[model samples]
Target: MTAVDPRRLPSAFWYLWTAVLINQLGGFVILFLSIYLTQRRGYSVAFAGLVVGIAYGGGGIVGTVLGGAAADRWGRRAVLLTAHLATAVSTVLLGIATGPLAITVAAFGVGAASNVLRPVAAAVIVDVTTPEQRPRAFALQFWAINLGFAVAAIIGSSVPDRHFVTLFVLDAAATLGAGLIIFARVQETRPARVDPAPGRGGGAVRGGGAVRQVLADRTFLVLVALAVLFGLVFMQHNTTMPVSIRQNGLPPATYGWLIALNAALIVGGQLLVPRLARHRDPAHLLAVAVLSMGGGFAVLAVTQQVWGYLLSVLIWTVGEMLHAAIMPTLVGALSPADRRGLYQGVFAQAFPIAALVAPAGGGWVMDHFGAATLWWCCLVLGIAGAAGHLVIGPARRRRLDMLEPSSTTIGVKARGT
Candidate 1:
């Protein structure tokens, strides 16, 4: 098979990619949410952290699962349109909400509505692209996501404290705009639902069977576990990193620049890293990425200097560049064509689960044990995730072999061994 250039991805893909870029640019609320809760809303650090976890991670878990099913059942375009519109409303409410309870509810709604798009967008890409083109396709999407994030971070961090409302309003407008684009340009790509096999009658039975199939796949389960471990370490940038910078006497804007640095590195590295790693063993590449991520966090354990943190961000961002494109490609490879949305949804849940658990735990650790301890823990988790990836390599290969005995030959002949 000839290599597909990223530039030649389908026109439909570019439309969806543009929507992702626009949505992320407007979705600046997440960039400063923890700070917003604690600094602006006058909540305690731990409580603020809990709300962040609940809003993004908790809501994301529900959204991924339900959205995946909905995408499969109803259609990708419908889910995208509804999720984005609902999210826009929820975000606007979050911005204007004065009471703590109102803010918390809106935060959860925003998270749920915003995250439902992940699997649906992924499924759409998979729907439109061939297997060989998937890596570059996912890479392009990741690039768009980070490009928007980099811009959002810069703006989010630099905005005056009094005008935080502007951030939410812009984010809502962007989300609604993205929904409009999907409605206008993006066609529904969900494959027609398969009629259930001879004896299965109700929707419940088919849904149950899908769940069992996903749950029973040990190889996929292991991948999800490794992802969760990596996610725990990765999520600290949002939950604890801002507080750590403040504790070290740097202003909040410093945290924004640090995150912007991460986004910048991803934008710079994403295109090149995937092509370089394409020929290498994915499992080994994943191991290296996890270790690199750990090393970045470990750097923070010893130093509070801006350069030190920047260096750490550089390390992990490279790891991120490597991992982002590979994982989704693997999920797409592992899934049956018809069940791609369900499988992607299951895989997507790992990060949100990590997002949910990491902040509350990281916040508690920072509160009691100090930021150094939290960083050390991140290092340990990264190493453990690396080990998990190594063990998963053989298992994954065996599973692929069982699923498609010709995969090795096809992969080698087309790309590399």
Candidate 2:
């Protein structure tokens, strides 16, 4: 099969892609939550770190599972719309909330609502596109995400302390707008489920079976494990990275630029990398990506200068771009047609689970050990995760080969006229 071009993706994909762009562009809440907690709410840095962690990592884990199941059971458009509407409401509440309990609760709600979109969006693309189209489809989606994020980071970081509420309000408005788009244009793309036998338990049994099927896929399970490991290292950008930068005497604004750099590289590199690596084995690509991530962090262990930080950011940002392009495509490739959303959901959960642990754990490590030690730990995790992927690569390739002929047929049927 020929390589797919991003321009030729189905029009349905562009609608969902636009929604992703708008949703990410307006995603200012999480970006600023740590700063809001520390500067606006008067929480300690450590406490703020924990709050951000729990808000995103904790809530995301729950949302991914429920949303994934809901997408397969209900429909992709329905889940997307609901998640966006819920996110708008929760984001508004999070902005207005004052007390610790109120803030934490609102943050959790926002996270839960916001994260549901990830799998739903991914599954929608998988539903509409063929296997050959997946890499470019996902790459374009990642490009859009970073394009929005690059703009958001530059603008959101500049929001004045007194107008932080505006950030949240804008985020809510954008989310609501995305929901409207889905409501107006996007349709349910989940494959029609086969009816169960007459006395066979209904939705619950089917859902349970879907979950069990996903759990039983050893290749997918290994992928999820590696994702979680990489996620732990990856999440530090939002959590430990800023804190470490500040501790090293750089200003918070520096961290903002660093993040913007990350987004910029993704925006620039995402399209190019996928095209270049389109023919390579995904497992090997993933192994290389993980090593780059580890190497990026390893750079941090010794260097405290601005240049050093930028170099490290560049390294991991490349890894991140490659991972973004390859991962969803791999998930799409592995998933059965009717079970795509559930499979995507299970894969989606890995990062949030990592998020749940990474922030709190990184915070604890930074507080007790030196920042250098935290960087060292990240290096080890990255390398170890890379090694795991390498070990699993041959088996994963064999599984992909087994699934390819069947997946091709499913892809054809899935693209009904």
Candidate 3:
């Protein structure tokens, strides 16, 4: 687990990518699951939302750690393929579920299965990619995630009255296809022959050893704190922002437009930004993007105009892409190779933490204060995250600065290899 060829890293990217495309398509349909429960299946929004979050938060809790562990102990492909298959099955069942209990069980199944795949796949990226090249690698992931989400958003908006079961079936099929693609085309990207020794090169390079080592790093913990904070604000787009938009007399069309704008920007900008950022430290990219996100929210807080809100999406999209590209790369750089999955899993859970609180909190803020007030609050969170990065750069800048360049950017520090 000492080194890799930089050119080969790009080749490996394809295998990691196969699963994401499918998951994202499923994610789009999955987004409507709660709405289906409340509007179609005769449940309250509160109850439905809670049910949806259960799948999200609960599944992430189980999937994040376990997926990472599986990726390390076995290999990335094993964890990813199994997770996708399980989610595909769960999604179909969830669509046909009649009773709350049935839906609940299905939700748990989907949550457990879908939530874990990303973290393992992310670790796989670090396993194959070099440090200097990691920004582009993560940027590719960000683009892929949004690509799936964007398609999901489009499908959700178009099929308002369609049977919920149909969506579930479609999600299931998409996930299944993704799994098949991964199994058929993607090679196992796990580094060969882990050296399980402590202290010195690659910060204790050993299979399963890096997991414990990464969790032990105080600085890494601090970065996770910032990621969690970032999640709180980021989750607003999915949770509260749409609610606010609805309150403004806009229909669901407005909501679709908003997410579409952001997603498109991210998909288009992710690759470009990393190239521009190649000359600068990722910390700078992180700082700037975060500040822009805060600024966008602060602006949204001051305006009720549709155009203003749209502009805010464009602004926030830039920030979103920046963070998306940098964060995983940074995490990869700071980790030991053996423990990449564990650290990635830990970092993946940040979103769940935000999701667990955001819906209830964002919904409360909208009802109690107003959408503008929520934006103001988001502004605070985004700015705080931006500032926190100043305290902790994307990578251990001190460590990375010492590495010599080769055809391969063996990011042992970043990937924890």
Window of ten residues with lowest summed lDDT in model 1: 406-415
Higher-TM-score candidate of 2 and 3: 2
Candidates in order, TM-scores: namely 0.93, 0.92, 0.88
> After superposing candidate 1, which stretches have Cα over 4 Å from the reference?
1-7, 193-205, 403-417
Runs of candidate 2 with Cα error greater than 4 angstroms are 1-7, 193-205, 406-417
Question: Which of the predicted structures, 2 or 3, would earn the higher lDDT when compared with the native?
Answer: 2
What would the per-residue lDDT of candidate 3 be over residues 45-154, giving only the tens digit for each residue?
A: 66666666655667667778788877877888888888988888877788788898888888878777887887888887777666656666777778888888888888
Question: In candidate 1, what are the lDDT values of residues 107-135, reduced to their tens digit?
Answer: 88887888899999999998877666777
Q: Please, what is the whole-model Cα lDDT of each candidate in the order they appear?
A: 0.82, 0.81, 0.72
Per-prediction CA RMSD (Å): 3.5, 4.8, 3.8
Query: What is the C-alpha lDDT profile of model 2 across 289-333, one tens digit per residue?
Result: 888887898788899899999999999988898788777877776
Between which residue pairs do clashes occur in model 2?
A: none
Best lDDT goes to which candidate?
Answer: 1
